[model samples]
Target chain A: MPAAEGTAPLAVILDQAGLDGLLTAIRAKGWRTIGPRVADDAVIYDEIETVADLPMGVGDEQKGGYYRLKARGDQALFGYTSGAQGWKRVLYPPRQKLFSAKRTASGFTIDPMAQPDAPLALIGVRACEMAAINVQAKVFGDKDFADPGYQGRLKGALIVAVECTRAGDTCFCDSMGTGPEVGTGYDIKLVEMVGKAGVTYVATAATDKGAKLLKAAKGKPAAEADLAAAAKAVKAAAKQSRKMETATSAKLKDVPEHARWDQVAARCMTCGNCTMVCPTCFCTTVEDVTDLKGDHAERWRKWDSCFTVDFSYIHGGAIRTEVRSRYRQWITHKLSTWHDQFGQAGCVGCGRCITWCPVGIDITEEVAAIHDSTKGRK
Target chain B: MAERKRPKLAVWKFSSCDGCQLSLLDCEDELLALTEEVRISYFLEATRKIEKGPYDVSLVEGSITTPHDVKAIREVRRQSKALITIGACATAGGIQALRNFKSVKEFIRCVYAHPEYIDTLTTSTAISDHVSVDFELRGCPISKHQLLEVLNAYLNGRKPNVPRHSECIECKANGIVCRMVAAGTPCLGPVTQAGCGSLCTGKDRGCFGCFGPMETPNTAALAAHLKELGCSGRDVQRLFRSYNANAEAFRKESETHG
Candidate 1:
C-alpha cells in the first residue's frame, strides 16, 4: 500500500498485484468493468474481470490505413491506445430490439425493451473516446428526442479516462483539440508514467462521481511531481501527433465551390468505412421487418452512410452516383455543413477514418491538396 | 349529422431511394399521433391502403425521368389540393441529375448490361417543371424535423418557418469556426440552404450541397472561390452537377464553368 490521500483512496500501483486487486475490488463493488483485452489477433474492447484479462505491455500501432498491436518493453495494464471497438458498443449498442409487437384481434400491442439495470465502469478510456461520448450525449441525452436506452446505460456509468501517452501516426486529436491530455467529459483521468521507477499512476477527478470513486479507493495523494510527470506525458503525446489543421464549427457558406472535392474524389472508393468508424457520424436508415406469418411488422433504424448510392437515390434514380460526389458529400458535410446543423465541426480528429480506410485516404492530405490548389486564385 | 372528417394525406413516389418516405416512418413516436391528425389515405410505403383523391396534401418524392412519371405526376396534381415535393429528387432532380451533362445512352450502357431494358428520359427534371408544387422540402433525404414542421404548418394553417438563408448563417449561429478559413478546406456551405443542421461542417468537413442551393445563392462568387482554391474547371463543373444538378442555379453554374 502506498501513502494514502487525505483519506484512503484506491492505492494499488496497477502492477501485477495491483491489477488483480483492482479487478477484485471493482467486481466486489458489483459493477461490470469493461477494458481493453486481446481477442483473436487484435486487442478489442471487452469485459475484463482479472489481471490476466488486461493487454499488458502492449501498445497499438496506427497509421493511415494501418492498425496493429505491438509488444512493449514493460508490463503496463493501460498502456494501449484505442482499438476497432469503442465504449459506444456498450452504451449505444449497434443493434437494439427497440420494441416488439404482437398482433391482436383489433390492433397490435407494442412492448419496448427494458432498460439496463446494471451500472458499468469503463476503464482505459482515451480522451478522444471521452469526447466522442460527450458528442453522443448531446444527441441522445440532452435533446427532446432523448434515446431512452442511451440514457439508461449512461445514467450512473463511471468513466476512467486514461490520458494517451503515445500518439499513433494516424492520430490527430490535437488538431480537433479533443485530446493529448484528458480534458472535460470524464469521471476520473489517469496519466501513466512507465520507466525505471516502476510505474506511477497520477489520477484526478473530473466529476463528483469520480471524486466519490477516488474517495472509495485506498490510494496515496498525488504529489506535485506526479502532476508534472502527467503534464510531461501529455506534452509528449501532443508532440508525437501529426499536425492536422481544422476549422471548428465552420459553416458551409464560407467555403466557395471549388475543384478541391474532385481532386479528393479521384482516389476515394466510396466504401463508407470512414463514416462507419467515425464516432460522430449519426446518419441512420429505417428498415421495416415483417414477420414470416405477415401478421405483425417491426420498424428498425440502422446506421446509414451518405457514401451509398441508395442514400441519395430519388424517385428517378440515385443522386451522387459517382464516387466523386459521394466523397465530396462526406467530407464537406463533416467539415463545413455540419456547423450549420449542429453548431460544431463534425470531426473530432480521431483519425480513425484515416487508419480504418482500406485505401489509406487521409483527410488532412485532401484538405492540404485543396488548399494548395487554390493558393494563388484567392 | 355525423362529423365528417380527417384531412386526407397521400404519399407518392416518383424516382427516389424511398429514403424521404422512410424519414416519415423514422418518426416512430410521432407516426401513430400523426395518423390521428390526418388520414394517411395513400402512402404505399407505409400501408397498401389507397383512397381516391382530391387528397388534401400529396407529398411527392423523386423526379420526372420517364414519360410515365410525367403523366403520373399530372394525375397526382389533378387529385391533390396541395402538392409538396420532398428530397432532392423531386425538388432538384437529385444525384441522378449527374447524367444531365453526359449522354444518357452512354450512361445506361456503361452501368447496365441490358441498356435496352432501361427506358429512361434523357434528363431527370424536378416535379415543379411539370406540375405546380405548393412547397419544396429540400435535402438528399429530407430532415424529419423539417418534414414534421411542414406537416404541422399545413395542419395548423401557418407558413412553414423554413429558413431560406445559406448554411453560413447557421454555421455562425452554431459557433462553428469556419472550415475554409481555419483548415483551408473547400466547402459549399456558402451557397447551400440551411437544413441538415450543418451536419457535414460539424464533423470538421466541408459541405457537399446536399440540401441544394439557397435563395439568391451567389454561385458565380462560389465558383470563383473554388477556382481560387485550385479547383479545375472540370472540378467546378462536377461540383454543380451533383445531387441538385438539375436545380436552375446549380445547373447554370455548372454550364458556365463547363
Candidate 2:
C-alpha cells in the first residue's frame, strides 16, 4: 500500500512541469482525467490528458444571462470561477441506458445494461461544486432506493478540488458557506499562486490515493511563505461582493403565493436552462424506444426539468399549467422542500442558474426579496 | 382469435419543397425496415407503383394553399385511419404562409406575367384547419429519428415519445453553448419546441424557430429579452417568421412587433 497522506507531507509545491507530469501520472494509473477546458466559448469539464489543456492565463466574466472568457494576462492556472457546467454530469450522466429487450418466442428477453467501467479523476473542482456533489449524494444515495449508476460512478471516482482565487460577477458560494475554501470530500486540494516565481500550486493530499499520486508526481515540499500566500488568496476570494441569504430555506415552502414568483415568472422564459445547468438538480425520466421492426426495445433514463408543463401531468391534464406555478415549484423546492426531502438545500450557490438564465433571473435576488419580506412580516 | 395484418402506410404531398417527405427516404437503413413494418401505399416520391388508400397510417406533407389541396387533403383524411402531418408545411403552413400576411393577388400581379392563370388561396393553412389531424410533427424537415419514433409509437399503440419542451433544453442537453445568452444571437429556442436537435444553435447561430412554439412557451418574455439584446421591432418580428412562422404563438408574437 501507499504511505498515509499525513505521513507523506503536510503540503507539496507543484510547478508547471510538475503539474504536467501529474496529469500523465494520473492517466498512467488507469484514471481517465476529466478537467476544465475552453470549449463552446466557456470553460466546461471535458476529457483532458495534458496540463496544457487547462485554461492558463484565462478568466471568465459571468453575470445573469452572461458568460465571456477573457485573458487574465497572467500564467495563473485556476484563476476563474466555476463554469456553467459542474461535476454532476461526471457522476450522473445526462442519458444512460437502463436495460434493453429483444423479441423472444414467448414475449421478450430483457438484458440489463453493463455497469460503468474506466474510473475518472475529476480535476480542478471548485468548493461550491463539491457542496453540490454532497447535496446530490444525499438526494440520490441517502434514501432507501439509491441511483445505481450515480452511486457506482461516484464511489469509484477521485476528486481533485481547486481553491478559488477569483470570484465571478454571479458567484455567491461564499454566502452559502460552501466555497472559496476547500472544505471536505476532496482527495487532493490545490491552490494556485501566480507570481514572479511562476505558476506554482500548493498541493495537499487528503487521502492515500492522493498521496500515492502526489509521490508519483515527485513535487517538492511546499515552503511556508508560499503556503501563507495560498491561504491569503483563498481568504481574499471569500471576500466576494455578492451574497445570498439562507433565510429562505425555512420560509419559502409556506409562502407559495408570494407575489415575487409572479414577477419573476414574467421575465422567466421557463426555458429549463437554469435547471439543466444546475449541479444539484437531479431529475430524470425514462424513455422507452423500439426499433422500426419492433424486434428490439431499449429504455433510457434522460435528464428532466420541472419547468416543463408535462412534468406535472396527470390523467386529466398538467397541474402546473401556468408559468407562475412552474417557477414557484422550482424555487420553493430548490430552497425549502429540498431541505425537507434531502436534509439540505438543493442549490449550492454556484450561480449557474443566474448566469445561464435567458432573462438574468438571479436566484439570490429572488430569495432576498422573499427573505426580507417574510422576515419583516413578523 | 383473428390474425393480425401489417399497418398500411401512405404518404401525401401538397404545397411544399418535399423536403419533409424526403426525410422519410433519408432514413436509408430504417426505410427498408420501415417497408417491412408498413405497406407504402402512396409515397410517389419513392416508387411509381401506385397503391390505393384506406391506409392504416397516412403521413401528409405541405400546406393547403390551393382549393385543390383543400379537397385532396379531406379525401386523404377520409381514406386514412390515423393522419399525421409532417414538417412545417402540413403542421404550421410553411414559408408559403408568409403570403397570409400579404395579398396573394398582388404577388401574382407582381411576379407572374399571366396573373389570371395563377389560381391559389389568399391564405395558406395547415391540414388540421380543415380536418381533425391525429397528430402534427413540426419541423422544416422533420428529424428522421423522431419520424421513426412516431411511426414506432403509432405501431405499438402508445403516445409518441416526443417531448413538448423548448429547444433551449435540447441545446443544453447536447452541451451546445447558448447562442442567445453567450453570443447575443436572437434565438427562438426559449419559445420554440424541443426538436431539430438545436441545428442552428449547434452551428453557433441563433435558432430560427423551425420547430414551432413549444408547450406553453413564454414568447412575450423571450421577445422582451430579445429586445434587450439589441433586437429592433422588425428583427424580433422576423425571428419568429421563419420555417414555423405561422404557428399560433409565433404569429401572435410577431404581430406585436414590426
Candidate number achieving the greatest DockQ relative to the actual structure: 2
Local accuracy of candidate 1 as per-residue lDDT tens digits, B140-254? 8999988987887777566675665466645543434445533446677767887787788888888888899875465776676677667888888888888988898889989
Each candidate's DockQ = 0.02, 0.67
> Backbone clashes per model, in order?
69, 0
Query: What lDDT score is found at residue B3 in candidate 2?
Result: 26
Cα-lDDT of candidate 2: 0.86
lDDT of 2 by residue, A248-362 (tens): 6546888888889889988888889999999999878889998766778899988899999888989999999888899889988988898788877788888999989988999
TM-score (chain B) of candidate 2: 0.97
Angstrom error at residue B229, model 1: 34
**Cα lDDT tens digits for candidate 1, A228-249:** 7778887877864565546322
Maximum-TM-score candidate: 2
Whole-model lDDT values for every prediction:
0.74, 0.86
